[model samples]
Target: MTDPQNWAAPGANQPGAPYPPQGTPPPGAPQNPGYQNPGYQQPGSPYPGGQYPGAQYPGAQYPGAPGGPGTPPGPGAVAPKPGVIPLRPLGVGEILDGAIAYIRANPVATLGLAAIVVTITQLVEVPLGIFALGQLAGLTAAPGDPADPTAIAGVLVGSVAGSAVGALVSFVAITVLSGMLIAVLSQAVLGHKMSIGAAWAAVRSRIPGLVGLTLLIALLLVLVAGVGVVPLVVLAVMQANAAVVVLVGVLFVLLSWAVALFLGVSWALAAPAYVLEGVGVTAAMRRSFQLVRKQWWRVFGISLLGGIIAVIIGAILSLPFSFAADPMSDPIAGVSIVGLLITSVGTIVATTVTAPFSAGITGLLYFDQRIRREGLDIELARTAQQG
Candidate 1:
């Protein structure tokens, strides 16, 4: 070396030092004794050197390691927006909100369906109601003397027949509407919009099954009530002991009502089950009963809450028309056709507004139960993501 102090290495210790102070590492090196580069995985890490834990290095699989090509998002990941309902298990509030959202999200399918069904129902019912009232008007024409028993009986019979006919028409209309709504809701839950025609197309084949299910449920309820009433009727007609007859009648009625309520709760999900699963009537009923087995109270509570809200809305909408139609206080003391028409209009409006929500909640409730019991949310999420 020419001079030891001046003979520094080729590029070191020049005008400005190219290297750090003695024992000081380079700029990219760890600054402290305990510091380790984020790019490096310390010992005990699941990754290899220079790979941090939970981080995907080159040629490494992602965290959570999804089992298949189209698995649903992991728990911490944000879920895709399914339609009205979220792609997750829902709370009661969510279910209610989802029901409302179904209407808002698919007004054409929901409102149009309700309108068509309600219009047809009103067409059949309004005339029958008017005719029934016209018949009853004769009974009240002369109010001074005791009305003839024969005429009174005839009026009652006519009223009953008209009511039966109206009820039958309403039943068919509602059943079809419900089937269509359920179909729409099923698609909506997957973030898909459906038209009235599309909803009908999806549900047309299932209408017969729905009808059969409704008829079966109705028959069951009728049989239950008859089981109680038939015995009481026979006893009363035979002039049996009044106390025994009353006691038996009360017990029978109570028993029948309890059975009906239990069955109703158990089969509450039948309509959606039938429409969505494409199961037969009996199979749908069985599926509903299975779904409700452990969640009976939850199903009952949700249904009761929805029903109460629907009843309140219906009452509120119909009240104005009821006051207008005040037959009891009318100067001309009989049902007014104008008032009846107004009331019918109010009913149609209310039904149009409320029926979709009723169907939506039931459809969503069916989904909620399936999620709780079958991990349906996972399937729904995967399907939503795929679409």
Candidate 2:
């Protein structure tokens, strides 16, 4: 495929003449006296000139553009403008459409994916619960002297080691679980599949890039905190005006958070691109940023909607536990063992339910951007036909 970025405008496509205004025919071009716009065809049918089966016009694809069965006229058609792939802005319907594609294309694999994810959650959650209990046990063990340097060093070492171990365990578990979910959903949405082992193998090859991005973001947050808090502490100690200092500090904090969010989302959005397109993480991220450049809000809105739905579902599931609180007790245990079990199960189910929708959006967004920026429709059709 040719690089759209490098491809000369229509003028270059047509030799020895100025490029026409994007859609207009060039000056003194063969003006057929009786010609009408080839793009003005009726919905769901071929263009008047009987163009390629999937040819799209500037505004949209011609009706019946050979998308999946039962796609509506709006999805089937292009947005507007020729020589450009239509970038369908992300929407709830688009997210659902991608999810449905995934399920329909790979039912067996999808179930396996759900089981894998939920199982990992259980594995981490159960062990982590016990670890927390152990930490509590340690802290209550014979309340040692606070001023003893030896005792303090031992406690500090133990605490840091425990926290580090827990963090490493959860990080690996989540990354592996999320990677599997993403690979499965990408296959599902693309109407393709590989064996479970093959899918795992594919993700393994990209582990370094994924792990690097994860650690990079983690370090960035730590640095931001250290920088911001240390200065604020110094300022407070020096008797500076607290309100002004805090406002300035808050602005920097917000800026840092925004940069981190953009970097994190861009990295995540490119995961499928890297795995499927054989692109490096950096290149994939560059590609994703380009794809989302014009439609950040649409993607953000879809994310917001998904988050809201997850929160609402989570809140409902959590209500029983909330009501189970033992207000009379000093510690006030929040739930019975049975209630805890139910809540854990509910949380796992919610995560499992929402995983595909989230993964599917990124996969679909990848496809949309690829199509628009790289003429991916042609390559996809060709790849499919060859297969």
By lDDT, who's the top model here?
1
CA shift at 230, candidate 1, in angstroms? 5.5
Model 1 weakest 10-residue run by lDDT: 1-10
Give one digit per residue, the lDDT tens place, for model 1 in 141-182. 877978799987988898899899999889989999998898
Residue 243, model 1: Cα distance from true site in angstroms: 5.4
The parts of candidate 1 lying over 4 Å away from their true place are 1-79, 142-150, 229-249, 327-333
Per-candidate local distance difference test: 0.71, 0.50
Provide the lDDT at 98 for model 1: 91
Give TM-scores for every candidate, taking all chains together and pairing residue i with residue i: 0.76, 0.64
Worst 10 residues of 2 by lDDT: 13-22
What C-alpha lDDT does candidate 1 achieve relative to the native structure?
Answer: 0.71
Total clashes, candidate 1? 0
